[model samples]
Target: MKRLMLIGITVAALAGVAAAAPVSVEIATEPGLNVTAPQKWLQLFAEIGQTGVRIRGMRAGERPRLEELGGSRRVVGVLTRRGDLLLPGGKFRQRDRAALADYFDRVAKDGAEGVEAPRGRFDLTEKQFRTAYDALSEPLGFATKDQPPRAVVERVRDRLPIALEIDRAAERTLNNAGPLAEDLEPLTVGAALAVMLARDGLALTPEHPRGGEVRLRVAVAGDVADSWPVGYDPPASPRETAPVLFEFLSVEVEGFTLTEALDAITPRLGGLPVYWDHASIAEAGVDPASTQVRFERKRTYYKRLIDKLVFQARLKSRLRVDEAGTAFLWIGR
Candidate 1:
């Protein structure tokens, strides 16, 4: 009898504790809040189980000012870490109530998981900027055989999410440039565009308008003064960025032209495309095809090997990124 009595007492105690603490949402209203706001919130959370929510108004001299929680006109409520949701009451439509409830639920879930939510407009803006950059970094490729600069742009514009614009001057030049003979290796959309544009002495420039849309514009290389490069300098060491280029390889060239050496080396670059700055090369009067290259049969990494070859040919090599954020080697005077 004594054992049964003790078991009954323990069960009663657990029941009382469970009843005392239930899942809930607190809806605290500020002055000027619509009278029906509390009822609406209660109904919204009704199916979400017993929300032990209470509708109460703030006292006249309460501390939090409207400015502290965004503006009254712009904000509906401020979610607090102190387990209270303060709503600045105003007439709310069904859609508005739904939106507020959805946001409230998200905040509660985030809080439970110990995740900090984005605060204010600055964090949101930064997030958007990062997203845009990420999009450009996506790898892209298309057929380049017999495709002229204009045709390449048109084909790429269809695949790209952002807008691609060609000004009148650039269009005239691109249309005249004959179809590119060489099919460029796979590269980022930005890098591919850079190579195609370089063929016509045109360049790509990004335009930002008031509405936060990013558009790429094609302009005459001479007219822009500065254009986006084929790829950016590697952020990491050469070994990390182009590990294959750092691997030792044996090469013996008795008397091969620079052009021939490049043709042989291009296949070993692990798919990295190479762009020739024709304009600068012409200005410097350097002909890679005629310049004879001599290499002693030795084991060396391609990085050093190419450097010596370019130096002998009176040219320089730079790692750069195109509009699509693809890395490529740009060889120029």
Candidate 2:
């Protein structure tokens, strides 16, 4: 009885040791392949495991070997035309194997565009490849809600120049009205304008300089603009400084009349008074309570919102600032 109990203790200790053992993955590389590529691929595997997985790279003529270590887990494989031949460690379950396979496939398809591998394989673009590599190595942990709206808009604006131009034009128009509307941030307004332009299937391409001035050509899905809003002209210049109403806002409405939309946003504008050019609206027969407006939950500026309202109502606005610094809106058809 004593001998049997001692033997059982020994077996239990061995099992514990095996469970705590480290896992390693070995990859064989072809000649002339970038050394860092293999390291990146290994890092991605480590990310999926949520642990530090060891990696070993073998050079050409070194036969790839995968063996079950007495007390450690390991993965062994090589990239091939058919796919990766992955051998998971003893600690890895069937589910883990599936997840690794799926991740590898995604990396190959989306990330590898012009990447050159050892076996004359060139599949991943440099950007795609780098992004894939960083996914495993660099983890972004911030929640989206914690991010500022203006920062988000700036990122989008940098990618689209036409969007920037549109925002500038809107700012100029709002500044012309003076104190009636609040100040506009180019990035925030640009992002909103970009979304609107995309919805209309419109794209703007700036033409080469002609006699010292540049003109923008509008295209709709690769075709010349045959139908667009009439009587639209680009604003002259964007204003640099003005009063700001709200720093950031996310508004969404559909099937709401222009007046109702304004009413809804008025409370959020820090009690800044709004005045409309009643005479111009009345003369043009524009009914503020009848025009429908729709906006999505994107970071927006007050001036950008006003620009949208005026465009939808088929009217123009002028800013009038009094000597007392009070701002008023004058609407014109």
Candidate 3:
């Protein structure tokens, strides 16, 4: 009877201890983004109770202020050019050489006091070029009536952006005469394409099937187990069910803008024939087969940009605007 009473008292004490103990648990999360991701991507993680910026993509670089946004919110991206897809010697021009030549000429002739100084490259006509040069040389320009003989003349190609250095690099890669692959430096993406082409044993040709011009429009969507991450690691799964998808949107055997063709097929993403607007893919990405991409304007002097974009899985998203500051950036599984 005495032992039983002691046991009862001990049980009561144990129950009290259990009741006083606190219960706690930790919740795990999906993988996030990398350091170079825009602040917006990181902010998403912050919203979801994570710290720092993490990223998952085709590649990541340690470049700060991508296109000069600011620290901690730089843009990290991949650049790809249209190559074998083009007919031999066929290329779309982005920089205007003539404009570049004339603009820099004025910079060399006139000092920094000149207001009409050129910035980078521009598209120009001969008449425009001549008129611009005349403005800088005239008295109304920078030089005085007495003319400053000692005025310093500096060359832009050598002084700023160092065009000569750039040209030398380009020349080295041009290869002059070699296999198309040898001549094509292909940049960073070539590594992957080379592997893919080799596996198929297929040699890409610049010539079109019809021996003319053709354009390809491509749309991309990335998914992740958890995209909004903090700090320097990549999303857990950069691989996706469909990381890349392409549509012929249009075909111009002579001259074409791939974007123009993409516009036509923009409405075909939904079930091929049925048109839909609203879609989602959990919290991850859009269904390329049924979605369109849009952009947001972050910098507007030349083009708009997106600070951050989020997409949901299975979402039939559309292009709100080509280069707007935001798009459907899918995150989370």
Best by TM-score: 1
Task: Point to the candidate with the largest lDDT.
Answer: 1
Candidate 3, 44-133: lDDT as tens digits = 335543344343333333221122222211222221222111111121122333442332232222212111324321222243334333
Clashes of 3: 37
Checking candidate 1 for backbone clashes, the offending pairs are 33-89, 190-323, 190-324, 230-321, 230-322, 231-320, 231-321, 232-320, 232-321
What would the TM-scores of all predictions be?
Answer: 0.57, 0.27, 0.13
Candidate 3 residue runs with Cα over 4 Å from true position: 1-185, 188-190, 194-285, 294-333
All models: lDDT? 0.62, 0.42, 0.23
Positional deviation of residue 192's Cα in model 2 after best superposition, in angstroms: 33
Alpha carbon lDDT at 102, candidate 1: 49
Which residues of candidate 2, in runs, are more than 4 Å off? 1-242
Superior by lDDT: candidate 1 or candidate 3: 1
Displacement of the residue 259 alpha carbon in candidate 3, Å: 9.3
lDDT of residue 152 for candidate 2: 29
lDDT of 2 by residue, 7-69 (tens): 764564344331223445565544445555555555566666624544454455555344446
